[model samples]
Target: MKITGDQQLIKKMNKTIVLDTIRQRQPLSRADISAAIGLNKATVSSLVSELIDSHLVTEMGPGESSGGRKPTLLHFNRSAGYAVGIDIRVNDLLAVLVDLEGHVLQEKTVPLADFTPEHVLEQIRKTIRQFSKKLPESPYGIVGIGIGVPGLVDDKSRVVSAPNLDWNQVDLYESLASEFGPNLHIDNEANAGAIGEKLYGAGREAQNLIYLSIGIGIGSGIIVGGELYRGTSNFSGEVGHMTVAENGPLCRCGNRGCWETLASEKALLDRAAKLWSDSHLDLEEIIQLARGGEPRAVQLLDEIGARLGVGLANLVNILNPELIVIGNRLSLAGDLLQDAMLRTIENRSLSYHRKKSGVAFANLGIRSTALGAASMPITMFLSEPDPALAQEGSPSAGL
Candidate 1:
């Protein structure tokens, strides 16, 4: 059946187009926006005015004169709003508050010895409050909060299960909403990491990319055609559980030798435990040792990288992504691990697959998850402003 567009919907679509045009081709004039968005000059002017009024866009006086006259140029006001993002893992929480342009305004990492839901939630709330206390004035203040959980998250952002953390049926989003308000989002840590890399890190230019979050456990986030592909059950990229060794040690998920059990940070630490009984030697220390030419450290990292490459080869053979970004704590291993990973990929994957996919370490480093999480709010504000915020008398009602 055919349907007609509502006047409001048409207006919103036009506004989005105009805003996107300005964002993509900034320092543009009315004529430029009109031509780029295919909107009439008058309509473009009205939308630009609305955007300016919303503090989402700004006028930069004038641009280089055409044959006729100089025109006022427009710029996207990235600092007009703010967002909060957090990455919750089994052992720690990383949180950041960022402006609309993806610059971190504030950040903190808290180690966790307790994995209880209440304890985790309290830590998150505390961090958010600390961030809120320092929020600078903006059109939108903490517009939304996005959290990345290292687990199976449903479409509604509920944690179905996180075997590593032993969490099941946890309503993280709902639990935080009462204190943080309605504008909260949650997703799998890998999925968040993928978008993080795509938006701000190594995968920025890659439309089809895979982000492998190799922390305590490995999780993947698939980006297809510049969009995240959340499967029917939102469990599409749980590649950690993909069995690689039939007789290998049993995984937390009851699987035998899942890829993560062999390649993840936990795996490295486990192997290192045999040589160095010091519990204080972190992944970073191990990587430093490997880089320093320590024989045992180098050998352990090679094994980890090879296992990681095996799983990556499986992904490359099937998906053929343009890039595969390895992030999370294990990424700290740097070239010491990546060289071995590339060698294994070259040996294990088909020539076609090996040549097509480029493996890279995450450029965003540890901030990937927090930045990506914060982007959710920035995205929502830019793409769809809250009606309440736009209403009269709201703090963010006017630019």
Candidate 2:
């Protein structure tokens, strides 16, 4: 009995070291892991044996021989576990499956109807079930679910306020938990976007970053010191409502002439539709017209970019981040929009901030929010767990 207990302890410790090794450094050889993790070669040999047996790690083909024989490289099996992420938007709900390394495996988009609270919730449930059906066989299938709602979200994932969705006091976490089990997290869309950029997108190495999401409306996610700064009420990055114009048009969030009222894509489209009221022309057509050097479309997009830059300048003044990631539908215009924004920012922002802050378009486009939502489960799981990870090598935490 004593021997068996000691063997068990050794086995668990070895596995922990191996797991830590594999997670921190990918595609390493057993010899490399043993050397890097400071575990005895023999101990690593035994633990890797067990990890391979459990399908957690696998040896790829082979690597070049160093001083000794060529050894097989080990990698975390991409299919070890899967996570589901949901992003709720006005037009659609996006669902995705992600692996441990935040690689999206499969994704689906479901068109939304009226977007009433109950209707949206029902759609979320149906789509989540649908997305989960695509997962491969795994011991810890669907580790958790993360929802990115386009609004102010409390730490609890509650919809503190989302005027676009007309949502308030909506317990997104509770509702999701009731249907999908307790491992559910909710966050505002912009926060999720920032997290996405940090983990899997352009802002991966940026400590102080701002993710400006220009979707139907404008919102931002601020990451300071490598963590999201959601403020006291979890409403820190709602830059859209900042009053650029005291006498601006009415905003849905009950603020008059907010920044978004003048510069958001929705606002621009509303203005464009009225100013150029040719029944045959549509929004995309207008964008195409500008892309083809049409005078009005080009002028309109430029003005929109300028207005957006004004908003960005204020944010740069307050938060001098290392990077500002511009993403969402409008970013699709590429330099056409960015040039105007840059020009305005140069004029409006202080020289120090203008020089320090670098602007990059969000390359992921519509997928930004969806990918952000999809990666949420993995982030939450890897970060602090609700009950804390079980003591080293305990079963209560992940295997």
Candidate 3:
């Protein structure tokens, strides 16, 4: 149980769950909501009434009757309040604004010449300020801001260890909260990618799913039974550090022979630099070259994909999730890489969980983690208890 210093926070949280559920899955009846959220009938009724009163949810026509009178369908007012997601990458920043139903309303990108936490924060703040100006009129204001970072995140929104950004123990939560005034949330990029995919990507239909973000560094975001599964200390998806090549290349995290050294985006780039270092090319360029019958680039990507599949094979054997989603820069490489990874994984997996699941590309592509950042603020923007839970903010509410 969590003892909060505030009581109003508890009430708002209760209604927030109902509102979020309606927004995520529309046209749900109160009965369906209660069943979906495991809340009792009376609580659902009160929360639904509160949402309708707030103009966040509205009752539609009747739904099919389940013995009793037909229940009224409920839906979120998509125009209620907006959420912004930000993706902080090594080369650029992707910012997207989504409405209540997780629809993208606006998107923008900014270039980054270098990777510095302080500089990125300024750029992020400016981008957020500019993006907020474009939102349509709303009553509740922008609910929150979610940030997808390329490093480890504590529950308090601090960047514990982002090897790519070289940020260690930086309190980004305080920095953003100080400027934005409490509407900031942060998570490892992989976790954000996982949530974006879970809520709106290929894994949306699966309860147990793994989202592998194979970018400059390899990381994973896990979802078990329809919610993010953060392990002790909230850094569950740091699988990139998992050892693959015991004596392989040294990693920025001071580890040797890590899976990241084999399968990370930088790993591919490191191999590519030997082939072409005259110009700084984006990930798309490599994919384009590999696509345009460039055998060397194609071969390089295939090998990288094979190694990534090898790394994931271990995870699949252990997690046995229903779906495996691949995201980030290399995902844009398409089937050329996917085929190699698939072949390798099928060969390595012990046949039982082999065909039990399928690999698919992220619908949101590289922007997924950033779009997930848009979802992050949902927690921060929402200060109240979730209506679906028996107790507000209890671990089970989203654990």
Candidate 4:
């Protein structure tokens, strides 16, 4: 019997669903998946068989059975392929090679002395080559690459603007697609961080959450109903540009009173510079000083935390997210900033809103963006009906 297009599509989708189920609840019998997803045992078995043929799922020894013969358990083949995730920061680029399960196999931090697009692109290419050289043997080596840019990435994966990197209208997808195949994703760094936290970190259990990347600038990734909510122009979470203080300091965006100018790590360093003119104290040094009970450093953190809280309270009042994850460089100062930040939120946000909202630092530390970025290509590759198509530009394919 010839299958129609609709039937083929449905079969492909069902196969994908089965693979996802196995990945999420691995080491489970085929019967468990059929029961869990309400599919018939025959259909589940067929899909699982297809997944196994595609090398995306594997079968283990028989498991204990409630009745009759024991059932063999199925597991997602995490080592079937690999992906590269890159997070472009103002001063450095963080790259990670991760398995299909988002497990980091290798990681590298490349310092960026130049913010020019050409230079950064070269660095990215070099890093990917290095990762390819060190990759472990797998069926689909280096399936694809995902990049988190510290700027506005359009729907077409174009870097519309990255103030920190001095980039505008940079088409990274076009630059890398020739060598990496079509499965490339470029998104705002904060958006990537939000996804990272949602899938594997602090926001895992919360459907609605916000990931705030507070480093040189404060950016946010808003997850509504477990999905990133990109605005009309794919520039939804520019919270740093929100005006908090009417006559506050100037921002790199040529705006006064922007939230980042007062709440971001840059803001903290700026204030610290004024207080300790003789010492060039970075965020780490200031945090260390605060930890050692330095009165001035403590006060400086308190002020920055209060400012951060002001913006956070506004976010809570407006979005009412279940959780707020603070990430990036500023999160390293979480210990010193918690009290004053919470206090400001308590005084500012609506009581009802604050009650349901919990604020926490990123559980993945500074690797949130990198891991999240890596997951994108893996997701795209796994979603393909034919796994071979996903391996077109992989290193194992001689690309």
Candidate 5:
């Protein structure tokens, strides 16, 4: 029978649904998929056949049947494609090569001595090439690349401002697209972290969660209803700039008493510097000191934790998220910060609002942004009806 345009679209969507079902509940038979998604046996078999032909699904040996003949089980082909995720951190870049399932195949950390966009771009290119060299055999080699930038990324994937990187109005998409092709994504690092946590880390079960990236400066990724809440200008979640203190310390953004100025990793370091004018201590050293039961270090971390709780309390009252995940550098001191942070939140936040909220540290450690960034491209690549579109370098697709 000749298929109409709408019929073809429907078929493509069904095929996608079939692939997703297999990915989510693998090692299931066609009858199982049909029953799970309410599709007919014939339609499910047809879509699964197309997926198998496309190298996205593989058939395994028959599974035990209730009384009749055994059924052939299907599995999603995770090794069919690969993606690259990069996190452009303040001091370095964290890059990872991941399979379709978001498992890291290779990981690298490149230090950044120069913050210039040109230099950073070169390092990114070099890192991708290194990853490509070590790539495993796959049908779709390097399906796409996703980058998480430490700045305000506009809807068009332009870096509007990143104070830590000294970047403003940088068009990373344009620069990288030529060599990398069309399947690319650039977003704020915190947004990427939120996605990472939601998909594979602490926020996996929470439909509404906030991922706070507390580092040199505070930033956040707010997930509302299981999706990142990008504001009207795609510049939401700049929680660091929120005014918490009327007469607080000066912030790099030219504001007084912004939340980051009082509660971020920099804030902790600034206070530590003042206490130990004779010695220089990084975050790791300070955390070690606190762990060793040092009075001053413990007190300092407690103070930072309380300050962090102030902002978190505000977030809790406003967003009422199911979970709040603290990530990035400050999260390394989660143990040291938990007591004071929770105490302050208990004291300050609305009792009703804080009751259902649970706070936790990042489960993926520092790789949240990198893995999340990588997942973006993988998602886009998989949503396409034709896998050849990725191979042929077609325009961007979405999940």
Candidate 6:
């Protein structure tokens, strides 16, 4: 078959253009939208009407006109629907309910003593039930749920492998689909963290970014051209497992001298135990000690920061992202390690590549993964074609 006019695709694309314009420049008039998107007044008006009918956009009273009549202004209805985001870790779960505009309406952090699929699923269901009861009436209620897991997650939302949790090929979507409907989605925690930063944190202004989640085990989220880059099989950003030393400590991923084994929070804690001779100190205490100018703690941070830089040099040499966000629990170390990290990156990576990449700490803190999960539904909802407009011969037919 040969391609033709395909009016539906054109309309869909135009709809996105109009919707995006309205979202960016709220209280815009039809004329303003027309000028912004280079679409005619009639086309803009038609799309606006459709959006209004769909409860996505609203008409405000009026705005000052160029000369003649006052123009009615348009606004994106952020409360048109709600989305749920869940970030699952080995010992904790963070769940958030967000409106269409990515504002957290309600959130909860629950401690988890169990990692069994049944236990985790039950907790998720209960949390969703609790959150759903509090949601305000809207055109779409709980539109979708997104989960960020700290391990290998497939395109279909299955937990392919989470060695930390000892999970293997757990079909998370299948387990929850019957109770939650088909809106549930899942991704690797680092990928979700990257999304969270892209949407709400330090990476907001960056088109190309790398989110280094320096947690118990290290992981990464790669963003390219403002989109999450999940390479074939969704295993693109496992930079933590990248070898940094020819012969060093073994990593849980069955690798020797992996970056995470030297620079991750787990590695820091383990090393701290040997030097400090205090086995009971948590990461926070160590970070606090470092903040207060403890010599050993400070030295530990320098070592970890240097290791972080070594891995980052490799990333800089390869991707040269505009921004590299250091995130996750280890981010709490703050300036204790940042200077050393930057210095190492400066010394290691090639001059030109190093110049192109800027490093920053994640501003969203622990909320990154959960918030990123919530953002998925909003992005999907905006880009998805309306079912009512899904004609048999449409480009998005049966989708």
Best by lDDT: 5
| Ranking of models by TM-score | 4, 5, 1, 6, 2, 3
What is the clash tally of candidate 6? Answer: 0
Residue 97 error, candidate 2, Å:
2.4
TM-score of 4: 0.98
Candidate 3 yields a Cα-based lDDT of 0.80
lDDT of each candidate versus the true structure: 0.84, 0.77, 0.80, 0.92, 0.92, 0.86
Candidate 4: which stretches are off by over 4 Å?
1-3, 395-399
Q: Which is the winner by TM-score between candidate 2 and candidate 5?
A: 5
RMSD after Cα superposition, model 1: 2.8
lDDT of 4 by residue, 137-255 (tens): 88788988899999999999999999888888999999888877888899999999999999989999999999999999999999999889999999999999999988888888888
Per-model TM-score, in order, reads: 0.94, 0.86, 0.84, 0.98, 0.97, 0.93
Residue 268 Cα positional deviation in candidate 5, in Å, after optimal superposition: 0.9
Model 2: per-residue Cα lDDT over 1-399, one tens digit each: 999999877766567667768877988898899789788889788778877876667888788898778888888876766777777887888777788776777888889868888888888777666666665777566767778888888777778788888887898776656556555678888888888887778898899999988878889889999998989988888888899998889888788989989887787788787777865454567788898998888998889989989998998888888999987767777677888889999999999977888888875666666667757655444443221231232111222
What TM-score does prediction 2 earn?
Answer: 0.86
Candidate 5 local lDDT, 1-399, one digit each (tens): 456888988988998899999999999999999999999999898888888888999998899897899999999999998899999999999999999999999999999999999999999999988888787987778899999998999999999999999999999999988788888999999999999999989998999999999889999999999899999999999999999999999999998999999999999999999999999999999999989999999999999999999999999999999999999988899999999999999999999999999999999989999999999988988998889866676321221
Q: What are the per-residue Cα lDDT tens digits for candidate 1 across 1-399?
A: 123457767888888888878877888999998877678899889888988888889998988887878899999988777788999987899999888778888989989999988999999888888887888987667677899999899988899998777799999877877666666789998999999999999998999999988889899999999999999999989899899898897888878989988998988888889888766578988888888999988999999888888998899898999999989988878688887788888888899877878999999987787788888866766776333453233212211
| Model 3: per-residue Cα lDDT at residue 61 | 93
